[model samples]
Target: MYSKKVVIRYTATNVDQPIICQLVKKHDLDFNILKAQILPRREGVIVVELSGSKENFDKGIRFLKEKGLTVEPVSKNVSQNNDKCVHCGACTAFCPTDALYLERQSMKVLFDAEKCNGCELCVLACPPRAMEVNIF
Candidate 1:
Protein backbone atom coordinates (compact mmCIF):
# COMPACT_ATOMS: atom_id res chain seq x y z
CA MET A 1 0.00 0.00 0.00
CA TYR A 2 1.13 3.58 -0.62
CA SER A 3 0.21 6.88 0.97
CA LYS A 4 0.17 10.48 -0.19
CA LYS A 5 0.07 13.91 1.39
CA VAL A 6 -1.94 16.63 -0.28
CA VAL A 7 -2.00 20.38 0.16
CA ILE A 8 -5.15 22.15 -0.92
CA ARG A 9 -5.45 25.90 -1.53
CA TYR A 10 -8.88 27.36 -2.01
CA THR A 11 -11.36 29.92 -0.87
CA ALA A 12 -12.61 29.61 2.70
CA THR A 13 -16.22 29.85 1.65
CA ASN A 14 -15.94 27.06 -0.87
CA VAL A 15 -18.36 24.27 -0.09
CA ASP A 16 -16.54 21.72 -2.18
CA GLN A 17 -14.62 20.30 0.74
CA PRO A 18 -17.49 18.02 1.67
CA ILE A 19 -17.56 16.61 -1.82
CA ILE A 20 -13.87 15.85 -1.69
CA CYS A 21 -14.19 14.39 1.76
CA GLN A 22 -16.99 12.12 0.61
CA LEU A 23 -14.97 10.81 -2.29
CA VAL A 24 -12.00 10.06 -0.05
CA LYS A 25 -14.19 8.39 2.53
CA LYS A 26 -15.78 6.24 -0.13
CA HIS A 27 -12.39 4.77 -0.84
CA ASP A 28 -11.86 4.00 2.85
CA LEU A 29 -8.84 6.25 2.95
CA ASP A 30 -7.60 8.12 5.98
CA PHE A 31 -6.77 11.80 5.95
CA ASN A 32 -5.82 14.62 8.27
CA ILE A 33 -6.23 18.33 8.02
CA LEU A 34 -2.95 19.86 9.12
CA LYS A 35 -3.02 23.60 8.48
CA ALA A 36 -5.87 25.96 7.73
CA GLN A 37 -5.20 29.63 7.44
CA ILE A 38 -7.66 32.28 6.39
CA LEU A 39 -5.83 34.88 4.38
CA PRO A 40 -6.54 38.57 4.39
CA ARG A 41 -7.79 38.24 0.85
CA ARG A 42 -10.54 35.88 2.08
CA GLU A 43 -8.82 32.87 0.59
CA GLY A 44 -7.53 29.90 2.57
CA VAL A 45 -4.79 27.33 2.40
CA ILE A 46 -5.52 23.87 3.73
CA VAL A 47 -2.86 21.21 4.17
CA VAL A 48 -3.96 17.62 4.38
CA GLU A 49 -2.35 14.24 4.95
CA LEU A 50 -3.72 11.20 3.14
CA SER A 51 -2.86 7.53 3.55
CA GLY A 52 -4.13 4.55 1.58
CA SER A 53 -3.52 2.29 -1.37
CA LYS A 54 -2.01 3.64 -4.59
CA GLU A 55 -5.32 3.28 -6.38
CA ASN A 56 -7.07 5.40 -3.83
CA PHE A 57 -4.31 7.96 -3.87
CA ASP A 58 -4.54 8.42 -7.60
CA LYS A 59 -8.30 8.56 -7.51
CA GLY A 60 -8.28 11.18 -4.79
CA ILE A 61 -5.87 13.40 -6.67
CA ARG A 62 -7.92 13.10 -9.81
CA PHE A 63 -11.12 13.85 -7.97
CA LEU A 64 -9.70 17.04 -6.54
CA LYS A 65 -8.39 18.12 -9.92
CA GLU A 66 -11.74 17.48 -11.54
CA LYS A 67 -13.36 19.64 -8.94
CA GLY A 68 -11.01 22.49 -9.84
CA LEU A 69 -9.12 22.37 -6.58
CA THR A 70 -5.43 23.17 -6.59
CA VAL A 71 -3.57 20.17 -5.23
CA GLU A 72 0.09 19.84 -4.32
CA PRO A 73 2.06 16.75 -3.27
CA VAL A 74 4.23 16.78 -0.19
CA SER A 75 6.46 14.16 1.47
CA LYS A 76 9.71 13.53 3.33
CA ASN A 77 13.04 13.86 1.60
CA VAL A 78 14.48 10.37 1.04
CA SER A 79 16.71 11.07 -1.94
CA GLN A 80 19.79 11.71 0.18
CA ASN A 81 22.04 8.74 0.80
CA ASN A 82 21.53 7.28 4.24
CA ASP A 83 25.26 7.17 4.77
CA LYS A 84 25.30 10.95 4.56
CA CYS A 85 22.98 11.24 7.51
CA VAL A 86 24.73 12.06 10.76
CA HIS A 87 21.85 10.65 12.82
CA CYS A 88 21.43 14.08 14.32
CA GLY A 89 18.07 14.73 15.97
CA ALA A 90 17.57 18.19 14.49
CA CYS A 91 15.35 16.97 11.73
CA THR A 92 13.40 14.66 13.99
CA ALA A 93 12.79 17.45 16.43
CA PHE A 94 11.13 19.59 13.81
CA CYS A 95 8.91 16.84 12.42
CA PRO A 96 5.33 17.81 13.10
CA THR A 97 4.20 14.18 13.07
CA ASP A 98 7.11 12.64 14.96
CA ALA A 99 7.81 10.68 11.81
CA LEU A 100 11.55 10.61 12.40
CA TYR A 101 12.94 8.69 15.33
CA LEU A 102 16.21 7.17 16.42
CA GLU A 103 16.54 3.57 17.54
CA ARG A 104 17.55 3.46 21.19
CA GLN A 105 20.23 0.82 20.61
CA SER A 106 21.60 1.45 17.10
CA MET A 107 21.08 5.21 17.22
CA LYS A 108 20.01 5.04 13.61
CA VAL A 109 17.24 7.41 12.65
CA LEU A 110 14.16 5.94 11.01
CA PHE A 111 11.67 7.80 8.92
CA ASP A 112 7.95 6.97 8.88
CA ALA A 113 6.57 8.58 5.77
CA GLU A 114 3.05 7.54 6.70
CA LYS A 115 3.11 9.64 9.83
CA CYS A 116 4.70 12.62 8.16
CA ASN A 117 2.54 15.68 7.69
CA GLY A 118 4.76 16.94 4.86
CA CYS A 119 5.33 20.26 6.60
CA GLU A 120 8.99 20.39 5.37
CA LEU A 121 10.26 21.37 8.81
CA CYS A 122 12.60 18.41 8.92
CA VAL A 123 14.11 19.36 5.57
CA LEU A 124 14.89 22.86 6.74
CA ALA A 125 16.17 21.70 10.11
CA CYS A 126 18.60 19.13 8.74
CA PRO A 127 22.11 20.56 8.97
CA PRO A 128 23.44 17.99 6.51
CA ARG A 129 20.68 18.90 4.06
CA ALA A 130 19.71 15.27 3.85
CA MET A 131 15.99 15.68 4.04
CA GLU A 132 14.23 16.64 0.82
CA VAL A 133 10.63 17.60 0.09
CA ASN A 134 9.28 17.29 -3.42
CA ILE A 135 6.30 19.59 -3.87
CA PHE A 136 4.22 19.09 -6.99
Candidate 2:
Protein backbone atom coordinates (compact mmCIF):
# COMPACT_ATOMS: atom_id res chain seq x y z
CA MET A 1 0.00 0.00 0.00
CA TYR A 2 0.96 3.62 -0.55
CA SER A 3 -0.21 6.94 0.82
CA LYS A 4 0.08 10.60 -0.14
CA LYS A 5 -1.29 13.81 1.28
CA VAL A 6 -3.26 16.16 -0.96
CA VAL A 7 -5.54 19.14 -0.97
CA ILE A 8 -8.92 19.33 -2.73
CA ARG A 9 -10.74 22.51 -3.61
CA TYR A 10 -14.19 22.84 -5.08
CA THR A 11 -16.70 25.61 -5.62
CA ALA A 12 -20.20 25.94 -4.20
CA THR A 13 -21.52 23.95 -7.12
CA ASN A 14 -19.80 20.90 -5.71
CA VAL A 15 -20.65 21.47 -2.06
CA ASP A 16 -23.46 18.92 -2.08
CA GLN A 17 -21.64 16.38 -4.20
CA PRO A 18 -20.33 13.25 -2.59
CA ILE A 19 -17.09 13.03 -4.53
CA ILE A 20 -14.99 11.85 -1.67
CA CYS A 21 -17.49 9.16 -0.86
CA GLN A 22 -17.47 7.98 -4.42
CA LEU A 23 -13.70 7.78 -4.40
CA VAL A 24 -13.87 5.40 -1.47
CA LYS A 25 -16.81 3.25 -2.50
CA LYS A 26 -16.03 3.07 -6.19
CA HIS A 27 -12.29 3.44 -6.42
CA ASP A 28 -11.43 1.60 -3.22
CA LEU A 29 -9.46 4.47 -1.76
CA ASP A 30 -8.92 5.19 1.89
CA PHE A 31 -8.95 8.86 2.80
CA ASN A 32 -8.24 10.60 6.05
CA ILE A 33 -9.47 14.18 6.12
CA LEU A 34 -6.92 16.20 8.05
CA LYS A 35 -8.58 19.59 7.68
CA ALA A 36 -11.82 20.78 6.20
CA GLN A 37 -13.82 23.96 5.65
CA ILE A 38 -17.09 22.90 4.14
CA LEU A 39 -19.77 25.52 4.44
CA PRO A 40 -23.29 25.20 3.16
CA ARG A 41 -23.75 26.48 -0.38
CA ARG A 42 -20.25 27.92 -0.43
CA GLU A 43 -16.75 27.02 -1.47
CA GLY A 44 -15.31 24.00 0.27
CA VAL A 45 -11.77 22.75 0.79
CA ILE A 46 -10.29 19.64 2.36
CA VAL A 47 -6.81 18.45 3.07
CA VAL A 48 -6.62 14.68 3.11
CA GLU A 49 -4.24 11.78 3.24
CA LEU A 50 -5.15 9.20 0.63
CA SER A 51 -4.06 5.60 1.03
CA GLY A 52 -4.43 2.55 -1.19
CA SER A 53 -2.66 0.39 -3.68
CA LYS A 54 -0.87 2.23 -6.47
CA GLU A 55 -3.57 1.37 -9.01
CA ASN A 56 -6.36 2.44 -6.66
CA PHE A 57 -4.59 5.73 -5.90
CA ASP A 58 -4.22 6.59 -9.56
CA LYS A 59 -7.83 5.74 -10.25
CA GLY A 60 -8.99 7.85 -7.33
CA ILE A 61 -7.07 10.87 -8.61
CA ARG A 62 -8.50 10.43 -12.08
CA PHE A 63 -12.00 10.23 -10.69
CA LEU A 64 -11.60 13.47 -8.78
CA LYS A 65 -10.28 15.27 -11.84
CA GLU A 66 -13.09 13.95 -14.00
CA LYS A 67 -15.58 15.40 -11.55
CA GLY A 68 -13.98 18.86 -11.88
CA LEU A 69 -12.39 18.84 -8.47
CA THR A 70 -9.05 20.57 -8.08
CA VAL A 71 -6.65 18.00 -6.67
CA GLU A 72 -3.11 18.96 -5.75
CA PRO A 73 -0.30 17.23 -3.94
CA VAL A 74 0.69 18.64 -0.55
CA SER A 75 4.27 19.31 -1.61
CA LYS A 76 3.22 22.94 -1.94
CA ASN A 77 3.37 24.11 1.67
CA VAL A 78 4.09 26.79 4.21
CA SER A 79 7.35 28.71 4.01
CA GLN A 80 8.85 31.40 6.21
CA ASN A 81 10.11 34.62 4.69
CA ASN A 82 13.43 35.11 6.47
CA ASP A 83 13.46 38.87 5.97
CA LYS A 84 10.04 39.37 7.54
CA CYS A 85 10.36 36.80 10.29
CA VAL A 86 11.24 37.91 13.83
CA HIS A 87 11.93 34.45 15.25
CA CYS A 88 8.70 34.81 17.20
CA GLY A 89 6.50 31.79 17.90
CA ALA A 90 3.15 33.24 16.90
CA CYS A 91 2.75 31.09 13.84
CA THR A 92 3.70 27.99 15.77
CA ALA A 93 0.70 28.36 18.02
CA PHE A 94 -1.80 27.81 15.21
CA CYS A 95 0.12 25.02 13.54
CA PRO A 96 -1.93 21.94 14.36
CA THR A 97 0.52 19.51 12.74
CA ASP A 98 3.66 20.68 14.49
CA ALA A 99 5.12 21.64 11.16
CA LEU A 100 6.39 24.79 12.82
CA TYR A 101 8.26 24.57 16.08
CA LEU A 102 10.49 26.61 18.35
CA GLU A 103 14.10 25.77 19.08
CA ARG A 104 14.44 25.38 22.85
CA GLN A 105 17.80 27.01 23.50
CA SER A 106 18.10 29.39 20.55
CA MET A 107 14.50 30.65 20.80
CA LYS A 108 14.31 30.48 17.02
CA VAL A 109 11.71 28.99 14.71
CA LEU A 110 12.08 25.67 12.93
CA PHE A 111 10.03 24.16 10.13
CA ASP A 112 9.57 20.65 8.80
CA ALA A 113 7.69 20.66 5.51
CA GLU A 114 7.14 16.92 5.39
CA LYS A 115 4.96 17.09 8.49
CA CYS A 116 2.83 19.89 7.07
CA ASN A 117 -0.89 19.19 6.74
CA GLY A 118 -1.61 22.39 4.73
CA CYS A 119 -3.97 23.79 7.35
CA GLU A 120 -3.08 27.44 6.41
CA LEU A 121 -3.39 28.53 10.04
CA CYS A 122 0.20 29.80 10.13
CA VAL A 123 -0.41 32.14 7.18
CA LEU A 124 -3.07 34.07 9.05
CA ALA A 125 -1.40 33.79 12.43
CA CYS A 126 1.94 35.25 11.34
CA PRO A 127 2.15 38.79 12.70
CA PRO A 128 5.14 39.73 10.56
CA ARG A 129 3.60 38.24 7.40
CA ALA A 130 6.47 35.80 7.35
CA MET A 131 4.48 32.59 6.85
CA GLU A 132 3.11 32.05 3.37
CA VAL A 133 1.40 29.08 1.82
CA ASN A 134 2.70 27.89 -1.53
CA ILE A 135 -0.33 26.59 -3.44
CA PHE A 136 0.00 24.54 -6.57
Model 2: per-residue lDDT, tens digit, 60-89?
A: 999998888888876566687888999889
In every candidate, how many clashes are there? 1, 0
Most lDDT-accurate candidate: 2
Q: Per-model C-alpha lDDT, please?
A: 0.70, 0.84
Badly placed stretches (over 4 Å) of model 1 are 12-17, 38-41, 75-136
TM-score of every candidate relative to the true structure: 0.52, 0.63
Worst 10 residues of 2 by lDDT: 127-136
